[model samples]
Target: MGALETMMPPPKRARLNGVEIGYYEAGPREGVPIVLSHGFPELAFSWRHQIKALGDAGRWVIAPDQRGYGLSGKPGKVPDYDIDHLTGDMAALLDHLGVEKAVFCGHDWGGLVVWQMPLIHPGRVAGVIGLNTPFMPRGPSDPIAGMRARFGPDMYIVWFQNPDEPEAVLGADTTWTMDFFMRKPAAAPADPPPSASGSTFAFRDLLKMWDPSSDARERLLSPDELAVFADAFRDGGFFGPVSWYRNFTRNWERSATLPGRIDGIPCLMITAELDAVLPPSAAEHMPAFIGDLETKLVKGSGHWTQQEKPDEVNRLMLDWLDRRFPK
Candidate 1:
């Protein structure tokens, strides 16, 4: 057994949505399963802690290194990573798991996909738990256009739109890219005001210009854990992952016909106190849109809320499952 699978279910793969999806799953198959989706530049390994904990609690849980990530197959084109394809991948995975609906729990970009599950494939989603990412209505303009106007082109999301640029930067040194991102926030992380470009995230105006050893930093992953991510990215490169961002405009354009608000379904929004990009304030209006909603804040955690504070995140998630979708 590899170091990554020491506690969680064994890694498995499936062909779904015309792409290869690598996943890990465990626990009873009797109830509505919990499907965990990962975010940008991440693998299913990111949920190493939650999968074991949640599975042990008697809930069927599946975590996938979604398309263009980890062991998953990467389609070459950009539009292939659109919101429909993302949500569809999960729905198809549910079909493979022989279940109809799942309580979707996602962190970072995974959260965005889970939030869209209700809109794109409403029948497949039993519930939602957003770790850091929030459920917001489709904006009046194309999201990429809004980001460009508000944060200029340097903003990471906007920066991702350019073909080959992000891929090159991130692929330059896979280990360094993973190392740069997988860090615990500085002891005294300053919630700096947004830059002149109007971007809310100043702490993470990263990639193009980052100091690997500037601050006395602590890594979120142990050397073995870090190897799992670095090695995967080293092979996969960033094209597939970055392509997800390239589809913002495409996703927004297609969302016009979909339901903007999440009604009926139970929801939980867990915000990280130190996550500048997806801060607690970002989730402020979620309750208004989600009629049945609950919220929690992970004190002192940064963007990597689940990995940083596994116990708290697990407690909150398991508690919600017990109340909202118990066995």
Candidate 2:
């Protein structure tokens, strides 16, 4: 077993909302618990490093695989993966664990979900931490139209709205899929990443767009660690995770009624200096909506900030956590 497998807490399961949630819990039952939500193509295993550190500091840490990933249940319908169900899963997890509220920290798509907990279920959130993803208030129009206009139809998010194709591309070659995603960017990309560099690469079109061996990006996981994802995904398949993108329109329609601004809660925004998809600038306007917000930048880091710079992310989290809520 790798350090990750050895250090990771034993897995636990609970029937939450409409699915069985696979989670890992540590530290004491007391204190305001911290729930970790992971992003696309990742599992609670992504938070393995933070889990032990935060738990050892006497903070209750809960990391769930979320629906459709890892040991968690994957419902058949695409609508089942909507924002309401995604956020509802965590709220249900809290009830299962017998906790009232928790400091929800999420990264990637998970970041998007944690940002909503306070709005959808206002009473169940103690604090909010958005890693790489910033708090995005609803735009005047449906985000899908904008995303399609901005990123083009072939863009991963927009393309995912189509059934079978996206997941088919991913599930066809599981090994290459994991390797394509779980890597540290080269100081700069050998080619641009759909940035304003006058170049466009549709990440969803992985088969033709980017090749695994063509670049020098570093591996974020060991062979053993990589297998954990490869094997689980081999069994779990990619539909559940990819279906999350399919809910863009439904999520928008439902969220139209939730409170737009977040106030009266401690929120932290951690930005990655090199995360082009969600750069520091994306979070600049966050203060306009979040009454009490603190921002930190992880230097020379990419999208996988927590795993890429675990020590720095942990320090920033612990320092702010200690000051805001005592254990």
Candidate 3:
């Protein structure tokens, strides 16, 4: 029906990690396997461009709708969405596909999963590549506590810990929510630093604080492309998606035993130059945590780096793969 629909198509379901995962697969069955993971409020559909590019270039690409998005199974409890369970979904997907190990690429929340997978399940990961989000090591405190101390109660992530409230607010108008988040952020407002006020600005107020006129939603997606996300969110609702944030503390506690550093894995971190939520500066401390990390800055791109600059992201991924996991 649309270019994305034609290129990426619908997903086939696979039972992995005790949940039914909706995934799209392409390329030769024997080709080098690569798993592409999408971020919050996103589906495998977000990876349409990379799926086609990698598939055509002779890769067995598998893009799953993760645990609680798209056509996948939606677990009820917030604890179910913790990092261990999230990484298990990917590990189980490989087992279901008869793959011992595969190159894993993730964006946003997906990036968080890939970064932790190498630390938790080393043997199952061949390499890790992150888009926008970087590998952040856990500090002495629980992540949610740290976030609360840094961003206060109104922060989108902090607000999400309440569960039902956020789900209701976000699901009330899925279309607007989708359009609002998918749009480019407005200029960085002059705000108090985290240390200055004991809490940085609240991103939960983005929809209300930023000017609607500045949003690039109309330019980024056609009604058809937007519908793909809006429709799925409408059906699945935001409960499962928001549940991901609710597990910040659980993930931190579970990962306490993991070594403070992630080594032995070839890692790539791509920074979206204009991404307000996770800017290029976020990766400054990455080298300390990731031993073999390689970094790239996607010029003129925002949070949706792969979707906004598909060719550049794809070329960078392909070249990195050729060098690290060569044929």
Candidate 4:
């Protein structure tokens, strides 16, 4: 339990854009506005700790479930789930709140959204913060291509983009998939079994073995915490969330035309050291994409930094926001 754990409180829900976007708001309504965006397979409740901390600090905090996940609007069309729609949903959410410009922060896929928001609607962003994901200068290369170039044959993104396969595999057993993704890594087997290559295991199985120790698993999440995620995914389904993976090329093509670099918008990037999905390598050369950038590494944490290490995450966020948009 880090500093954020003690300061956080539960969030409230809202109905926006023809869908119920669960969100939590704190701080003074008249204070500076900070909008927090959630990543795939995550709800606005993910930022529960930060909302209370930031709000108590006298800064207005807004955390939304985003359009496709949780109670937010989930459209049927694949094309409808494009980056334009995703970013547009954020803009509409801001408009709904009558906010002119807000400090934007996000993690994982949410980080991608915050990074692009400043580009798509530069006028509406006061500053930006990205967790896990990094700023890659847009070019002819797509996200899949970048993943392939970086991870080689065993690329998760490439596997995820395979249309219905992932949805079928993960959707069929949501709990199994959740357990797999949330689990920590394990130690190597003492005696390598015959005909047992680590590569032979399914991604889900391998992820389950990530933290073989029951103690680590217990510390990863409580039954109640796991239930929170399970309920959301069970209701939201995997199709809409997986659709985000299918939009790699679409996001790249759209981002290619924007200016090569961001100017004047202060930025902060917090990388989780133990996040299996998003390793430190992912953030390489991020400073090349933003004018003013600050980077921090949270040791002994996984992809769910906000949930796993709330206090540290909150402190870093508050420190950065205080510097960029002082009250």
Off by over 4 Å in 1: 187-209
lDDT tens readout by residue for model 1, 1-327: 556767557779999989889899888777888899888778888888888898788878889989999888989999899998999999999888788888999888999999999999998888999999999788999888887877666677887888897788788887888888898887645544455566544323555456776745678888788888888988988899989988888988999999979997899999999886688889998877898999999998998988899999999999999998767
Model 3 TM-score, 2 decimals: 0.92
Q: What do the candidate models score in CA lDDT, each in turn?
A: 0.85, 0.88, 0.83, 0.73
* Candidate structures ordered by TM-score, highest first: 2, 1, 3, 4
After superposing candidate 2 on the true structure, give the runs of residues whose Cα lies further than 4 Å from its correct spot.
Answer: 2-4, 188-201
Candidate 3 structure quality by residue, lDDT tens digits, 18-107: 899999998888745999999988999999999889889987889999888998999988778988889999999999999889889999
Comparison by lDDT, 2 against 3, better one: 2
Tell me how far the alpha carbon of residue 36 in candidate 4 is from the true structure, in angstroms, after superposition.
1.1
Backbone clash count, each prediction separately: 0, 0, 0, 9
**Model 2: residue 169 alpha-carbon error in angstroms:** 0.7
Best by TM-score: 2
Clashing pairs in 1: none
lDDT of 4 by residue, 257-326 (tens): 7877788888898998877667676887887777898999987777788877889999999998887788
Preferred candidate (lDDT higher): 1 or 4:
1
Name every residue pair that clashes in candidate 3.
none
Pairs that collide, model 2: none
